[model samples]
Target: MNHLRLFLLSIVVLTSANMLPAGDWPHWRGPNDLGAAEPGQSPPAEFSDTQNVLWKTPVPGRGHSSPTIIGDKVFLTTADVAAQTQSVLCFDRQTGKPVWSTIVNTGGLPREIHSHNTHATPTVACDAQQLFVVFNNHESAQLAALDLNGKILWKKQGPFSPEQYKFGYGPSPLLYDDLVIVAAEYEKGYIVALNKKNGDVAWKIDRPQISFSSPVVANIAGRDQMLISGLGKVCSFDPKSGKQLWAVDGPAIATCGTLVWQGDTVFASGGYPEKETMAVKADGSGKVLWRQGVRCYEQSLVAADGYVYAVSDDGIGYCWNAETGEEMWKKRLGGSVSSSPTLVGDLIYLFNERGKCFVFKTNPEKFELVAENQLGDEAYASPSFCDGKMFMRTADSTDGTRRETLYCIGE
Candidate 1:
């Protein structure tokens, strides 16, 4: 089904229970934006090009952004260096066919980016009515809202210049009720929340530091606060008021991983000038529950039960008690891993840079590998799940002639 038809059908079936369907990955991680797949739906443990692979389609340009799914359509962003264009692509969730591709920006870049980072590093977010995308257009960052049919509803410019981040931008927009919050952490940091209806500035907070970590919202102490880590601190802000509730100083500097929230505690890790992993109280007390030397600079940690799991950039998987910071188990999964693991039921799905997909049990007792499968030549972008299907993006060939592909695995 096309996007327009799906939107119309959704309006007719719009009930309290069906507002956000169980099988819609509306954001970077998933519906909850916490790297959790839909319940009762299991993607295959083993899949390859010819085994359990539903479909494989060629993506047009280079993108480190992951796929976002809403109802019957999947959304992703890509940038073509030669053409100097950045685009938002929509594909049919079932058929793996192209639905529409909308160019959101044109012209060359304003500054040089890191070799590993692309201009389209940020992932898109979606709500019931529209899709929100962030593009670093030349000097200014642009946030746009588009209908399901690829029509632009509104567009607003962010607060920072691209040149501020010498490396590049990697933060994705966080969508709450009727606001889309974007973080621009350069030499000077600012969190801007735009009105989703008409793209006006709703609230903005200024923090002077460089960061690449994305913000996540969690309910703690009967309030919803947005969490972001960088510049020697992990701060919590009132999502509705944009007021700083509390800030904890640490050894953080330019963090890449997002925080993992479980119950009344949240775990955060950062890499670069400093290496530290910490679990902090989430009740606005600014108390550090525990601190450790373990770090996941690039990939985010996943918390389940009473434990948290993280795969370092060098491919070492560590499971620790979420509250005590004691190590439960540590094992090595070969090859570098930048993609965060997705938790489904009791199994954790981890993909390495070499395209090796590792399925293991999220056991706090020991490291248990259930299955290992190879999918592509290289994959840095994380996977998304919806309706029992898994979507992955792979870009092979480090040279200019890169072959970017999107794969759908199921059954």
Candidate 2:
């Protein structure tokens, strides 16, 4: 396998995402950035709170960020809304116990975020020796690095408060080579790369216009490139040097899901103002193969083989021929969906907003429903997989009280 992942992440645009024997899910979209774990592991096809669950731990606070597993430790970011603080949480992967918690931001919480949004929304990313996390606290995006034991290594902030659209920050920090990259797309936004060692500015660029998508790095069209879609454009940049390789007019002006690619074609989807899904060639020729009206708002799409699969924001599942943008099949999985589809071998795991877990085959011929499992009544965050378990973040909002729990689901 490619040794490229001791860890891969976005907070997620994870093209920098997914992993193996390293057996860790240290990034958002996973080590491969494709929302798929390394193929050998067996995370249960049907699992619930008591069934197929090896362990479960109550998370201290709430955040939509996914779990990031590295070594024996699992990491997540949370914010105490009443306390106005944001912190990094560590958990024991074996017994589902609390390991340590480090407070990263104490105050400066934004006055108004969307009712559905939280102060801590980015997944923590690590590069072997250190753990890195991002939070939209005190009106700016703060990036912090901590040692494996929860000691703060360094913390840096980039201004990101927008005047009109303040939905709160969502992009996770992306790691490439020696730098950690972050995209804070407000009206006056930027994509900045910082030195992982001391959090210094390596290179920075202005991402005007405002888009909420995370930046992901992938090797497509024969070269390593960083990709993100928003601000009325689909763009590729040189990951090492921060140079614009190529950019084309986009599928829309605002997008939340990270871009996913297959073969030489890059796929990007929805956001505010307009909604559409598109496939663009990544050869710097800026050719757009096809465009569709399907929108996947807060969740990213997964591209595999020659086909792409997605669960639309409205609770519908879709399979499209990646090469031709042909709609092979789309099934209504029901309820709303905020979590992305996770591909484990030929089986794909999907979770709807109401906490419905759907497992299905990747056969493009039709919608193949394998199994359906239900967890908490509310699930907004995505799941992370490693070894033989699935780390699922779910919550119970019954009786109007919200409590979040992280469940380790396995065979």
Judging by lDDT against the true structure, name the best candidate.
Answer: 2
Error of 1 at 342 (Å): 0.7
> Candidate 2 lDDT, tens digit per residue, 269-298?
987788899999999998999998988888
**Stretches of candidate 1 exceeding 4 Å from the true structure:** 1-19, 162-165, 398-400
Q: For residues 300-397, could you state the per-residue lDDT of candidate 1 as single tens digits?
A: 98887778998988899999998898999999999988888998767899999888989999889999999998877788889898778889998767
lDDT value for model 1: 0.82
In order, the Cα lDDT scores of the candidates are 0.82, 0.86
Q: How big is the positional error of residue 183 in model 2, measured in Å on the Cα after superposition?
A: 0.4
RMSD of each: 5.5, 3.6
By how many angstroms RMSD does model 1 differ from the true structure?
Answer: 5.5
